[model samples]
Target chain A: MGNRVIKMSTLYLTEQGSILHKTQRRLVIIKNKKIIQEIPIFKIDRILIFGNIQISTQALSFILDSGIICSFFSSQGKFKGSLRPVESGNVFLRIAQYERYLDKEFRVEISKTIVYAKINNEIKFLENYSKTNFKEIIEELKKNINNLKDKNSISSIMGIEGHSTSLYFKGLSLILKNKFLFEKREYHPPKDPANALLSFGYSLITNEIFSLLSGIGFDPYIGFFHELTYNRPSLALDIVEEFRTPVVDKMIVTLINKNIIKEEDFQREENSIYLNNIAKKAFLTHYEKRIQNYREIIKVQCHKLMDSVLNKKIYEPYLED
Target chain B: MGNRVIKMSTLYLTEQGSILHKTQRRLVIIKNKKIIQEIPIFKIDRILIFGNIQISTQALSFILDSGIICSFFSSQGKFKGSLRPVESGNVFLRIAQYERYLDKEFRVEISKTIVYAKINNEIKFLENYSKTNFKEIIEELKKNINNLKDKNSISSIMGIEGHSTSLYFKGLSLILKNKFLFEKREYHPPKDPANALLSFGYSLITNEIFSLLSGIGFDPYIGFFHELTYNRPSLALDIVEEFRTPVVDKMIVTLINKNIIKEEDFQREENSIYLNNIAKKAFLTHYEKRIQNYREIIKVQCHKLMDSVLNKKIYEPYLED
Candidate 1:
């Protein structure tokens, strides 16, 4: 007997349509005379609508009740605003989340853990390629991991994280067998397909962690490792740091190397590169498969954080075995 | 551009397993060393577990928050009970639902609507098969539809519903092209594959409507047409009547006639016929496809009901044109 769970799917409403009024708890998608897709709001974590899509107020209410986020983006792949549930989260967790910021020792400890895990996962990923050229970066990552352990300042930890990511991507670029270019992790309107994928994948994972943390009663905007900035979900970024290499980076690399995603998967407009409809679907399918592999990894780490805040258990970051 | 929705899937934990605690807002399904399924709790409507499956306290709490239902049934295919969110539903809607039952005129009005819709949909169904052979049943259905309009008692409406169902199934049996037999609509351990599928399909639709009605703030146990009894979701039953012919019955008949479901798809143990794993999967796939056609139909009717209670809008039962 196996424990079976219902897999929740991300509803990508990329078509130029509008969401009709919800009837019987089902969200209706009408395209002209035909009802394109009818999804139950309960099974959705986020609604990522691209291009000219309109969501009714009723649909948004159900999305909020289901504790999912609705993100709207421009057709040219520019990031827009997201609709989130009203911030009526647990005050106790919120207080604890903010309190950790004032505790310099606590902040350093968590920041060090995130940097260590990120660097460690990068080393593990490069090792999987069996390329001798990556030995330099791997050694560099190892040294950074040790450096991160003694770091007492959040600034120094973030500086090391930035350095390690640069080295990791340089090493990753060498292993990408295809013509898909990855040039230094450019994010805002990515110039290449590879960067576009990395940016898209990161947003997907970040939003996922944001919803999970919020559902667990934490304020998504507060953070200890990452500074709470204007309109930024800093807590999500803090938690997403350790997961970058293993989840999003690895998935994007695999998609490129396996040639499952290609140059044609992108739409070129002026200086920007965006994922075409086919590529978005392919990337999502592959990401879902990849995410399942690390689902426990993400859950376990978050639960440990909750345990630390509520039950006084020590927060342990996810480190590759 | 078309509308898109997230499809809610039913999770059947029939493997005598237990649901682990919720982590990261996603339920962990552990069976031995393997993690079977990790689903977001909000994305699930009902967890149908058959025989010896256990759920943890934490998982139940998440289920309650998401306004979903978890049902348990015997391995012998008998429904045991459902763990619905504690009856903390809107007092206003529940009061309206209960008040309608006390008003005999109100009760008859709603009952007549349900019967009229059920009979009208059946006539529409038979007309799809042939114009010649079903003329008599069509006329009978028309007579029942007219008779239903003037009915003042719940008992007489129930009688008409019963008679119309008999005639509908009789017409259906005539149209079924396969060797698979459909002697009568049987439940409590269906005797044949067709009957088993019909019963199973009906249950799935009924449970769906139950959750939908409950989600819309209606108490599932209260009803107008069907009498509220111990352990019965009478309101769900009352609403399901209008949908049975179009959604469930058509799906079962199509599956059998198209030979998509075979006799081998069932397992016979003494006198009971049960759907085998493969057949169950095929049935669900087709059921989902079939239900999508009427997704709007169900939603529209439920919305009408909600409006009737909240805004005094005339409750319109679904009448197929």
Candidate 2:
């Protein structure tokens, strides 16, 4: 109808955050003793909470009812966790998802596709930002990919991934802007702002894929590229590898090059750089926009993964051209 | 990876269809006693069988392995059935889907949104194609929509939908190209080419939603607008209401106006008309293109429905401006 309105994609909560509560059949955000924003529950898709955001029981229930995905990140842009709706009701998709992991040949084949896509995209990214020839990294990546043809063991596939990623990161170091320093890829408590942004960005994408896979009734804890762990969403991590370069790495480079995020937005603490609240907000905004731009591609990739699991078809990771 | 290739969306099989089988790790399609096409298992998403299509067990297993959806239709373009992979593994999404139906207020609220969007888009479509004033139809639609505000009974809502849809078909009849006759919408056997296309197009959209809902772990049988019936995917039918006019109706009008489909393309059988093989292919091609065009919108609407079921948020149907 003419009176209809477009729904907002992600709701970013910040600035001492706010206490979200139900008011007059609508969800309202209150901050600094003032009402900030009130939206009809239906208008929101995801809630991106940065820092200590408070929520009332009614609001949480409404969120559950709305099936909105809520993502929590620390003040330093570290991913805490997410509160999403329950898994899909279809039990068979999980059975198929689980069944695929039992096939060693299938696991190795798919893992090769994921890691190859990741390394290749990394080579492409570094080539775009740096004048340095990534010939060596590219050569090594190609060799390992060729070796994947003869490899049918998960451990061998993982070894190739680990070795190739180090070379990819070494090339990544050559592309950073002068003020931003990148030595190696680090996950917990990143040593520099770039690493911090990269880690946070990776978490954002991982959460997204996790929700998608879980929503589709896949066991995210079991994966091919990444080994199964007690608590980690290994499958999401496996898929995350392909996207890390084009989605996260690209965002980090653009943020630094364009001066969207700066050293002032990060705080130094015990050999680690933490993104301040303001920087976190900026990052969240950009992260959401980036996701929106690639929403179609991401959705298609998810379906492709589903197809692979159900049909034992090849699972090719996302490769940015 | 460089070796990876994009998968095709739909594979249409015609003319005593084909004997599909696996040969040396590839799925091959044989028609008229000759091999016509051979594609890797991963390259296909769905197989559209228009006539007497034959499949070997090995081929069926290969299709299942490829996770390829198989949709069967009569020569007249009537939907027979579809074979898709098992539903999503998550049991909770379906639980929420079923729970929502128990809440009368929720059912009534969502039904209103769906019917309103359907009527509104129908009015828009007819107005675009008809030179005649649609004031009466528009007024009737508005009256029923306003009446929907006070009505909560499922029967009452369904009554409104039926009445509104009749008026909509009446408006549709006024907009068809001169040679194309559309007296009334007949589903079991479409009375005219227009009606045949309409039924076939609706079937395509319904199946798409069914697969998506199943993938999201919602029981396609449970719904808000349409009443549940044995062997009927009522929920998919309910959601299909909002999409019928905008996606299917608009495409039908466009196909006629552009001369993509002509009266000669159909054969009269007693009182009904059936699309010839060539016409069916044209329609399928256009159908696929149209689906691709609205793919993003359809995906968003499904997510919105999921949001509504899970979060108690108002489910807003897609409204074209």
Q: Model 2 over residues B133-244: C-alpha lDDT tens digits?
A: 6778878888988888788788888899899989888887777786787877887777778988888898878877876776576667677788765446778888788789
TM-score of 2: 0.48
Q: Which stretches of candidate 1 lie over 4 Å from their true place?
A: A1-6, A18-21, A65-67, A76-79, B1-321
- Local lDDT at A239 for model 1: 83
- The reply for model 2, stretches above 4 Å from the true place, is A1-8, A23-26, A84-86, B1-321
Q: Assess each model's interface with DockQ, reporting 2 decimals per model.
A: 0.01, 0.01
What tens-digit string does per-residue lDDT give for candidate 2 at A55-165?
A: 654565456556676666555555554544432544455546656766777887888788778777876776665354677777788787778777778788788888988
lDDT of 1 by residue, B1-321 (tens): 012114645666655544455677787777774777677766665676555554543465456556566655554344544544422335355445545556788778888888888788888888887647788988888888878867778998899988988888888878876477787778777887778877887887887787678667676666778865544667788889888888888887778878888877778889888877667767766776777778767878887887776665567888777
Question: What lDDT would candidate 2 get against the real structure?
Answer: 0.73
Per-residue C-alpha lDDT of model 1 across residues A73-184, encoded as one tens digit per residue: 5554444544444323354554455456556887788778777777887888889888888888889888888887677898999999889989988998898754786767
